[model samples]
Target: MSYEQAIAALNDQWSQGDMDSDEYALERERLDYERGEMMSAQDAPEVAA
Candidate 1:
């Protein structure tokens, strides 16, 4: 599955109270930051290798 899909699934799990709050928050934050970076890179102009 895609990162976005996986994150959404994780979020659902958290919402269902199956995961610890602190751990969920930390993981969600990490995923969000990484997702943001991926989005940023996608928006950036490509440079020749």
Candidate 2:
């Protein structure tokens, strides 16, 4: 999912308290890592197929 979508989901999860602080932190970190990976992939130069 996109970062915005992930953030929205995280907000909802946070509001629901479905996750503890540690869980929330880990999930957020995972989302951020995913987002960064996506960004890096997007920034990479594409090779001709």
Candidate 3:
């Protein structure tokens, strides 16, 4: 899942009290970084086939 999607999912779980604030923040950070990495890769030039 994308970072934003993951974050939203986490938020849902957080609202349900399935996770604590620290856990949510850590997971959110992880997802955000993963999303950033994916975006960076997409921004890179494509290699010729």
Candidate 4:
């Protein structure tokens, strides 16, 4: 699944109290970092061989 979808599911879990605040915050931070990395990679210019 996409990062956006995963994050949304995580939000649902947190909202439902299936996860604690610490765990939710850690997971959300990781997901956000990963999403940022993916987007940065996509936006980077290609290098010539």
* Per-model TM values vs. the true structure: 0.63, 0.77, 0.76, 0.79
Q: Each candidate: how many clashes?
A: 0, 0, 0, 0
lDDT of 1: 0.83
Off by over 4 Å in 4: 45-49
Q: What's model 3's TM-score?
A: 0.76
Task: Write candidate 1's Cα lDDT for 1-49 as tens digits.
Answer: 6787979899899989989989898888888898877777788748323
Q: What is the lDDT of residue 23 in candidate 4?
A: 99
Report lDDT per candidate.
0.83, 0.84, 0.82, 0.88
Q: Any runs in candidate 3 off by more than 4 Å, and if so which?
A: 45-49
Error of 2 at 46 (Å): 7.3
Predicted candidate 4 versus true structure: per-residue lDDT over 1-49, tens digit per residue: 8997998999999999999999999999999999877777778747322
Question: Per-residue lDDT of 1-49 in model 3, one digit per residue for the tens?
Answer: 7666777889899999999999988988888788777777788747322
Weakest 10 consecutive residues of candidate 4 by summed lDDT: 40-49
Q: In model 1, what lDDT does residue 12 have?
A: 94
Clashing pairs in 4: none
